[model samples]
Target: MKMDAFAFGITNWAEIDRTEHQGETGMAYWRTRYFGNYPNQIRVRWVEYTPGYRADHWCHKGHVLFCMEGELETTLDDGRKFVLTSGMSYQVGDNAEAHQSYSRSGAKLFIVD
Candidate 1:
């Protein structure tokens, strides 16, 4: 069967409640299993955060972050900082360093793994 046959859906993040964490604020996540099976997975998520909000220092197993709207300021464990805006994307390998993200005027992101 075609992937799209079993993997089709839409989500509105603005209607979901925000998840809060220490050092992180005004954040929210909406996850969906779109395609593939367990072990071999395909998932999509929408992440957002408001101004002055920050994420804890952590790394992903292996994933890519695609900016959908607004701006994001990311700081890696190695002290490297990146300023990302809409239409921007980046990768975080298994060996990726821990990092924190903050926003000045709120931001939205799409995470695919």
Candidate 2:
């Protein structure tokens, strides 16, 4: 299906149940469209973290994180830490460090690659 600019639909994360990954924390809002009957190389997902939640240490092929709400802290394997709040965004991967995220008041992030 072809979509024009601004022709996509809005997907609400709260309406869907969170999928549990064995070692990951937070709920995820996910959506994707295939290209030419095959999976697309890029994916966009919104991840919501509850208070006192943290994710397992992992590395991505390439990713960008956009903080949509609340606060989140990420600690890298090298002990470097970054704190992000609403309206902030960062890119990682292709030499991206391994890291984990933690939130106290909860947070929502849009991740894309």
Candidate 3:
């Protein structure tokens, strides 16, 4: 990824407005901040998943996702599954794989894509 030049800044996630996204089985809330513009923009988010959450679709977009609290399970379309707990993270490239997420006990995460 090419990162265009930009100034450094700090974000107070609590001050950001959260938008809700319905999952297949539960709900997800996200506080997002964007740097640059679409096509080349970087999306940074603070996300929360409710218990029993399951992603509604397979995501082919890449991401750098970090688990901040609780646990999360990510399953690839090919039947591979991986788990993430606090302090754990995963990185994937754009269009590399189609994956979906699930959380049995809910979770908090930081993601950039």
Tell me each candidate's RMSD, in Å, in order.
4.1, 4.7, 0.8
Residues 33-64, model 3: lDDT tens digits:
98976678899999999999999999999999
Q: Give the whole-model CA lDDT for all candidates, comma-separated.
A: 0.70, 0.68, 0.95
Per-model TM values vs. the true structure? 0.71, 0.69, 0.97
- Between which residue pairs do clashes occur in model 3? none
Arranged by lDDT with the best first, the candidates are 3, 1, 2
TM-score of model 3 relative to the true fold? Answer: 0.97
lDDT of 1 by residue, 1-113 (tens): 11233555566756555554455465544444345675565666677676766775565455688988999887787889999999998777666677678888878888877
How much does candidate 2 score in TM-score? 0.69
Better lDDT candidate (2, 3): 3
Comparing candidate 1 with candidate 3, which one achieves the higher TM-score?
3
Which lDDT tens digits does candidate 2 get at residues 1-113?
A: 22223444556656645554433655433433222222334455777777777776556456688999999898877989999999998888755687777887888888876
Candidate that beats the other on lDDT, 1 or 2, i.e. the better one: 1
Highest TM-score: give the candidate number: 3
Off by over 4 Å in 2: 1-18, 22-40
